[model samples]
Target: MLYREDKKGNRISALGFGCMRLPQDDREKCGRLIDSALKSGINYFDTAFMYSGNEELVGSLLGRYDRGSYFLASKIPPALCFTKKDFERIFRIQLKRLGTDYIDYYLIHCLSDYSAWNRLCRMGIEDWIREKIESGAIRNIGFSYHGGTADFKKLIDSFDWDFAQVQYNYMDEFNQAGREGVEYAHSKGIPLIVMEPLRGGSLTGKLPQKALERLAADNQSAASLGLRWVLDKKEILCVLSGMNTEEQLSENTAIAESAAAGCLGEDEKERIEFIKSAIRESFVIGCTGCGYCQPCPNGVAIPACFEARNNFENGKNHPVFKMNPARRQYLHSTAVLGKSPMNASLCVKCGRCEKKCPQGLKIMSLLEETAEVMEPAWFMIPIKAYRMINSGKKR
Candidate 1:
């Protein structure tokens, strides 16, 4: 409901609606939720080429509303673009997908390094972006990032970008772009669009009792507290959260309207650090389970693999591999949900998923790590037996 401006003087909702995962079914209900958000003053809408049906659904739902009433944002995935024609082809297709002639915000999706940026330049993407801007097919050029801090700073300074999106949360303050990236982008007069402000729902989950007591002083949910922490930064233009329900939309909008920079006092800030410390102490793989890196060309159940490994390491009962809950769940994913009982050993070390990941994880290495623990030949028999028992329970 609250608004902030980008460097170009465009007013964006502080709580932008991330259209990455709108309900694929029940679009009428989806329309109602989006309409409710618009009525509540949310004007910034974000979608992407890689988000499956999100852009198409957003186009269909927003068609009833005037185009000028809200800002439309989407991305161009360089990995999918083999040639300049490929680059421009997708942009035209995106406009058609969204039923809009001009995208208010257009980004180079999931950029990670200078070599990649150079390749885009070599493919004539930079000029093509300009042509789109000049012709009014795209407006306010920018990028969404998943990279090292140094690379982030390089990219931000490299372009005359209108804004930039990054994976920023209190938990990842030193991980991706971190606090330094925020300051550098601001110094160059670039407004920041923060993604994963809730760390993909990790921050919204229950914290330790002592940590909860610290946040209880403010009378807010952990989710609210997490959102506010990002919204609290003045340099941020908007923080995007993918809300799936009306209740979540309302709660997020309310937080956006009220959260301001420096609103968290010293004690509250310290409390956040305490909770963050606890989260850091838990030995878990840092996958948010966003499923962005998915449908592995090789049919590897990548996200499921990571989730199982994380649960194995972090779950209280799963202190060791033999006792890990992920072992059971890992089998469930491939056996019940997957086509076969695929595990990390199936990985070919292809780096396609890494490029898509917002968290910038070393996925192939992690998959290998997962296989080392979960794919021992001696454990296969027990794991399969456990899977059969779990299946029997369902009957």
Candidate 2:
């Protein structure tokens, strides 16, 4: 596999295995995938404290290998930190979970903007990081970002960070911490680790028909095309993919083996633009499902609502009579299987989510549209019945 050097001159694998989406039910398959990744020479593993049991899972799987052989990365959630002691407590908990004394790369998880980082600064994070680094408990310090480009630059300047992880891809080139942020961080000698290189599978399985046809003409699968686009840029230190299947792992590894800066020819560049245009035309909503606009006061599942609507709209090319799976998906995710109804219709137009969205979307109005399209009488009747039955059972 290809390699890139970080600020400390550590040779990290270009293709880092993202552990957030590891298959929870199938331990054996997960182990084999992790094993194959290690055997294939991928040395960087990324996880986080908030990824729910991921650190323990990664620890158990990778504990067999010599610690020095691979670079293990994980994040401490700043949202969970309110005081100096909280940082210490969380760090200790993460260490126990990972079964490792030192984390090779440690990050402030999902730091939104400069103000957020500044809050941590007031809580004595800088000194805490210094002590950890001096004691060899933390090797590299950084943050994973989910804010705009302007705030991103300020955050980089605010800290003595060794690296920064951001959501970047062909589709998100101009979105959250986009190309501009990538270049700005690179200029300051901060190595960039990219998450969501495929935009949470939107660029792969959700591609429009025209985009798929363009890829077919070039003999490229959507996953390979998306990954290569990100890896081709020399500024990127590593591109993280949350691989859950063998096919995804195999395809990604092969792409990483031959990928280099400026690997794409003119013909390939044009094809990517064509694909982008096709997606733009078909995409009904630009939500990245980042969950920044989460926990609505009125209990609206904001991201899930947008995702289902996008899925429904993207299926326009399918046969007219066929029931869109997105409809069922919406019902299942928002009401039927959930403890309470969290569908788009629950939106009260409070506009609280709009202030938090990194993409600057008109969330309140878009949610109205979602309710109109996704919450017909047929869907709502069953959801209402389920809620009544469940509530009565509780009583």
Candidate 3:
């Protein structure tokens, strides 16, 4: 695999392994994937506290490998930290979860705006990080971001970061942190690691049919088209992909092996823009379905709700709501048939999920919109009645 140097001069693989979506049911499969990644020369692995049980899984898999052979990166959730003690508490928990004493590259999970960083500073995060780094408990310090370019620039200039991670892709060239944020980071010599290069798989498996056809016409694989687009930039230190299958691993590694900076020709650029247009035609919401905003206090299945809504909007067939597969999927997955409803309509406007979302989505407002479209009173009344009756039978 190709390599790039970080600010610390660590030779990170051009393709890093994202450990967020590892299979929970298949430990053996996950193990093999990590082993294959290491053998294929991928040294950087990224995970976070918000990714449930992911740190332990990654820790267990990497435990077998010698420490020096790979670099493990994890993040501290700012939302979970209110005091300086919380930082120590989470860091200790993270080290225990990973089964390692030191994290190679550590990040402030989804630092968001410049003001959030300032909040962290008030809570004594800087001194805490300094102590950890001095004690060899943390290697390099950085942050993952999900805010506008102005805040991103302010944050980058505020601190001497060793690296930063962002959600960057061809489709998101001018979105959160956009091109300007990336260029500013590069100007300051802050090496960048990219997450969601495939826009949570939307640019590949979920691409509109027209976009897929265009990719086929150009003899391009969907995964390669998206990945190579991000890797083409010299400013990118590593591009992270959450590969589950062996085929994904192989395809991604092959792309990383040859996708040098500025590899895209004008023709390829045009094809990408065409695909973008196709996507935007039917794209209803900007959600990437990352599930970072989760476990809603009100029992809302946020990501699944958004996914159903997106699928419905993107579908070519104009099926009636009662006969729609999207509505059916939403009903079943969100537990509309169960004792308690978990659909978008059930959202309580608690605003907790918004704090956790990496995309900085106005989730409460979006949920209101989703409920209006995906869960009409005429459609949900019968289901609610059935549940009321079924609830008695179970009791």
- Indicate which candidate wins on TM-score: 3
Q: Over the full model, what C-alpha lDDT does candidate 3 score relative to the true structure?
A: 0.90
Q: Each candidate: what lDDT? A: 0.82, 0.89, 0.90
Predicted candidate 3 versus true structure: per-residue lDDT over 1-395, tens digit per residue: 99999997899999999998788579999999999999999999999988889999999999999999999999999989999999999999999999999999999998778899999999999899999989999999999998889999999998778999999999889988899999989999998999999999999999988998888888999899899999999889999999999899999999899898888888889999899999999788878988878889888999999989998787645445446677777888888888866889778897889987867789999999999999898878888788778786320
Ranking by lDDT: 3, 2, 1
lDDT per residue (tens digit) for residues 1-395 in model 2:
99999998999999999998899788999899999999888999999998888999999899989999999999998889999999999999999999999999999988888899999999999999999999999999999998899999999998899999999999889988999999999999999999999988888888888898888888988988889899989889999999988888888999999888888778878888998999999988888787878889988889999999998887643376577888888887786445677888778888889988867789989989989888887767776677667676320
Model 2 TM-score is: 0.93
Q: Candidate 3 has what TM-score?
A: 0.94
Model 1: per-residue Cα lDDT over 1-395, one tens digit each: 66788887888888998988688788888898889889999998899998888899998888789999999999988889889999878988898999988999999988877678989888888888888788988779999887778989999877678999998989888887889988899899999999998877777763545556666775768887788889889889998989889999998988888887666667658768888887777635788877778878777888888877766666555555546676688777755323355678778987998887867789999999888887787776566566666664320
Q: What is candidate 2's local distance difference test score?
A: 0.89
The residue-level lDDT of candidate 3 at 202 comes to: 90
Model 3 error, position 188 (Å): 0.3
- lDDT leader: 3
lDDT of model 3, residue 181: 90
